[model samples]
Target: MARATMDVMSSAPGDQAETPTTSASEREPTPAELAAQQGVPARGASHYAKGTSANMMRSMLVIVGIGLALFLVTARPNSVTPESVDVASAAQYRGGQAGQPFAYAEGLPDGWVATSVRYARSKGDVMVWNAGYTTPDAQYVSVQQAVDPGQDWVDTQTNQGRVIGRIETDDGTRWVQRDREGKVQRSLVHVPDDRTELTTLVTGTGSWEQLEEFAEHLTPAKVTKAGSSPSVSTSPAS
Candidate 1:
């Protein structure tokens, strides 16, 4: 009975040791244990994730700031209407000396605004004195004097407008009227009787009567000494 008891004690200790080894093999390792096995710190991965999140947030904020700045710049106010301009003063300033042989409008209707003036050479090196205006009714009108421009220049100025009729002014000055169908403008061209190197062209959206009225006011001054052409000056007219 003593020998059987000793054998039973030895076997019981061996069974208990084997049971613990089986349990340890079946159990899964924790994340910390797995990281330790791979020689990496578990807390390092968490810190890296937090840093990535912070970087993403900073990028988003930068994009939003740029969008806000663009919105503020685009929403700023701007002026739309053109300002008033003086034609005669601008013409004189642009090489239209008194007593010079240059074409100018003498008596425009009240409230008519001159918007721009230019003294330059056109095609064929013909010097041109031009002025743009806005009528009281908000229509466009322009007076151009081409020095010795031929029929081609007239065609170019009128945009190849068809010859409609003639306008006889009060001063016995005859103007050839041209109409451009399917276009926004018409023109009145006057070539002096003496075939002088000066052709006056008034063209725009104004009616024939308005254009004739404008043409009647044209008075070409005789310049003793034609000065050098001046640079173009443009301004908005309302």
Candidate 2:
């Protein structure tokens, strides 16, 4: 009771905070603070009361701000988003190379290699294009084509409208499924280059959360200038 009231009072604006109660002697405490007073004998209640009141007010403001920020982000999320580390378009990505451009990010070990991929929009709801290479073994085009099948496989696949992107590489499919335990899963993987793939299966998915997660891990190969190639970055632990 006191904790909830304290939360309400703290969340109220400055005017309300200062709007002294009808009986000015009444006060409430945080959930934790209220719990501590049941049996323990301590210093003056006034000692922490004022400080805690201030802290509560500060916390209220922080929480309100965070709520507003979350609302804004959730309400207006990006329609088409790309990741920073392994983006298909950004030239800064420094993975993948000549016949081995795709990097697999999943339940793999340290020995699992990663190459960059480049994706381009070629005039459809989903487009896949090339960026360049991070290694000499990276495939330049296969990585991008597998993820988005644009116009090719659209005619053959079922529920054609449900599919997205292009699939130019090996035998890869992006579809919805359920595990043996009856959990929901949405997955997509493409290895146009190396032909090996990685996937993400969201446990409980509703919106494009699964697709968003898949895009988050799908990286593109990095590209250098027309004449020069990108230098490899070494890991400290390696």
Candidate 3:
């Protein structure tokens, strides 16, 4: 009986040891392990977080590009308006200081903006008066007056142009028009019969009609009761 019991116990232990036992390394692969083996990222919290960050970055860049496009479409910054300069005040100051019969435009219709004015001495001690204006049609026109000027000065002011023809004003006063090499500038010269008088010139890039209109409004400057105040001629120059 003792031998039988011992043999049974020994056999039971041998059977238990011989049966196949699963080790930690021999278990079935989990979902995450399967994904890693397949070269696929697991759908975890961290992975979803990275995907959301990438999406947000792309969305921000798209928004910024759209905003920039809208701004460019709305902003038209090419055509700039020229700032108007105060020609009257400058002309007044110059006339008062020069103490001569300075010429300036007066009683002009609207849209005539003076861009510049000056009364100063030029080469050879020649007293010069200049006033520039933007015409109603956005053309440039200027008045140039010099006292006892030489031929060289005349040539310089007229851009070394050749006398083409004559232009008559309302008062039958004749002006000599010069033709320049290019259409860049035109000149109407009023050469005083007496060399001692003021040689008035109307010149600019304006059309002949615009130049005539500017010349018609030319008047002699006068000092006001306030001595320094500038005054324009009541009537146009003859």
The candidate that wins on lDDT is: 3
Tens-digit lDDT track of model 3 for 1-238? 8566555556454465332456878999999999999999886675435768788888789999999999887775634454566555656666666655667888889988776666667767888888888888778888888877887888888889899899888866689998688757889999888876778889988888888888888877664333556444221111
**What tens digits encode model 1's per-residue C-alpha lDDT throughout 50-125?**
6687888887899999999998888664323335555555555554453335555777878676666676777777
Q: Candidate 1 vs candidate 3: which has greater TM-score?
A: 3
> By TM-score, highest first, what's the ranking?
3, 1, 2
Against the true structure, what is each candidate's TM-score? 0.57, 0.20, 0.60
Which stretches in model 2 have alpha-carbon errors above 4 Å? 1-180, 191-219, 224-238
Candidate 1, run of 10 with poorest lDDT: 13-22
Report the backbone clash tally of model 2.
Answer: 38
Cα lDDT for residue 169, candidate 3: 88
Show the colliding residue pairs in model 3. Answer: none
lDDT of 2 by residue, 1-238 (tens): 7667766666445554533255534656655666577755544656436777777888789999999999988877543232213333233333232223333333322322333433334334533333222222211111233343533443222222233443222224444422222433222333233224322222122224433333444443444443354443322110
Off by over 4 Å in 3: 1-80, 223-227, 230-238
In Å, residue 54's CA in model 1 sits off its true spot by: 35
Which candidate model has the greater lDDT, 2 or 3?
3
